[model samples]
Target: MLLKPGRGFFFAIVLSSVAPVAGATALAVDPMTVLIREYSRGNGSYEYLNSGTDESYARYILDRPSSPYANIKWSLLPSPDTPTRRAIESVSTQEHPVNLRDLHDMKVWDLGFTKAHIASETFRMPQELRYVPGAWSIVKAGIEPDIYAQAIRNQGLEHPAMTANYALAAQLLRAKLAATPPSLWKIRGLRHDVLDRFVGGEFMLAHDFHYLIQFLDGALATWDAGSTSAYGFRQLPAPLRLGRIAAAYRQRLPFEHEPCMEDDTHDPEHAGEGTFDRRPLCFDDATDRAIHVWYAHELVQELAAIHDRANGAPTLAERMAAPLRSSRQGWIGIPRPSAIAEVTRIEVVEAKVTGQLLVEGDVSYRDAFGASRRALRLSCGMRP
Candidate 1:
């Protein structure tokens, strides 16, 4: 969550001779569909001028026996009536279609539509929504740090090709932040946003793929962040999963800045549509609360390694420093920040989690600065 945002062109490839083998480290993202979204409209209207699939990734899925990512959903497969193809059709009448051959610059940042699709206002199709695992969101950072952390956690070791780019992205952001002057250190703090361009950027920077299926699959087996309704409407799973992952990793996760008053909030889906009333938010997955704490405990250990490392422990930080990524650039490798010396880093003055709480806030959007503030805690008088 401490990484920074970047807007620059990157051109590099990491080729590998590794083959898919069941039970071996591999990723299962097949000719992935990359959204070439040019614009987004009101009323959820989206226009994707073009998109393409990575055939190599597709083959990896077919060859691999185990994978965490849901296998090629029927909708993702290329066919005459595919969503991506149909999406491009919608934009054709408005402007000339963007064909695969027409993409002259695949260096991510160089694409004409890179910044547009990265913004939340832009549109995205179902396939683009699922395929694009946002890794770098520089502009529409709903809340910078949270976005960066979620993206890191969401890199749940699935979709090897995508993970490779995330690793690269993490490294890039960290390097730039570390290089900044001390006075400007505050400018480099992490942020959270849902723009899909970050994921799209990672897709273009990918070198290859693998599938470490089933790894950490059970980490949350005893927990369920959320699920869909009978009508197929899904819920936000980040809050639920974030606490659990932090606990699983045993990271002493920080709570969101709690608001003074608990009040109503707006619904994110129908924001300007003036549909739902504002309501208070609270974290109440008590069934898994204790484990959540446990995961947070583990997470902090990894974070510690990032700040100080001698390269001996086989921990997450060490592994991240040198990840199993096939990409030329790897994990957001942490660098000694230039201003860290002058900066007052977070320190343990008096830390305790005896009856700790998991403060929850409005899901409509991140409550970062001011305005309508809200907070709800998910903790109780019980022991794990």
Candidate 2:
């Protein structure tokens, strides 16, 4: 019987690292049977296992410790009768199996898959959906600035491995930023589409993954813009548990962009086949909403830092120079599009516990058109 579409109903699951089960029946049996046996034995928790090619299994892994089957374990054998073996057989028949190995040798700019996947008539899986995280993606996941901030606010101390991951991600991001002709990075502008180029061209996975990637890319972009050095960002988190939770969820955390609207609206099982409506997009989804809130809090903290630094200067010259100094040497590390000549005034309109902050101010800056003063209004997830 086809299981009802739930967190994990096998559409396709990719299994890697199949370990040998110690003792099991030689006869072929369904995976559900093993699941039942374990449940019957009253094991409250079991090891997580990967098998199959369907998204039910993929989404199950995407949900992680939050999923009902989070603790369950099932192993696959060389025998073709196993569910995992069947999935491998199934994927082998598909014209486009979600494999990154095939695309590795291709240059990021020359990648044809991004346009191809977007233009395809039928839905195809993106690389972010893979249960086993790609080496490129694992490195990309650790470079998140907000993740570092979250680590600071909630915990102070990163796992050695996570620190290593973040450090690697920073190094790669810097290399990518530096190697990129200034023109291309400007063209990319820190968006989801950059994943196609930046993280190794793979199919667009989930909108949530794209959303998070945008944030990380933006952070690195600031580094490129001379806001702060990589070493400076590391200094802030060196004492905090920045990557401890991430360490527990390593590899998994990077691809956990599930519960995204793309799955809800586009997947045949969830939204009904051929009903393809992109209108119910990421911004409307619950998970993305929470992420937005987190980003909002981070923004408030950033703006608050700017306000405190600029307003605290004892004299007008210092006050006017405060923003520029902060931009160059401050801890907040946000990027500025143009150099600030002076911050004339700052008024905090509102600050809320819900992670919303509103501030409006008069600012003077020189750009290509020359210097001018204007009122700048800043709000989390809002403008004007």
Top model number, TM-score = 2
lDDT of 1: 0.23
lDDT of 1 by residue, 1-384 (tens): 000011112222223212111111111111111221112121111111111112222222222212111122111212222433433444343334433212211111111111111222232333322323221121111113433344456454422222323333443344334467756755644221212334333431111122111111221112111132111222112222333233222112223432112321223332221112222111111112222222232333334444435566444333342332221111211132111110111010000100010122211121111111211110121111
Q: At residue 361, what lDDT does model 2 achieve? A: 16
Q: Would you estimate the TM-scores of all the predictions?
A: 0.19, 0.22
C-alpha lDDT score of every prediction, in listed order: 0.23, 0.25
lDDT of 2 by residue, 175-252 (tens): 456667776876755342433332432332344233433343333222111122222211111111112223222323
True-structure lDDT of candidate 2: 0.25
Q: After superposition, how far is residue 108 of candidate 1 from its true place, in Å?
A: 44
Candidate number achieving the greatest lDDT relative to the actual structure: 2
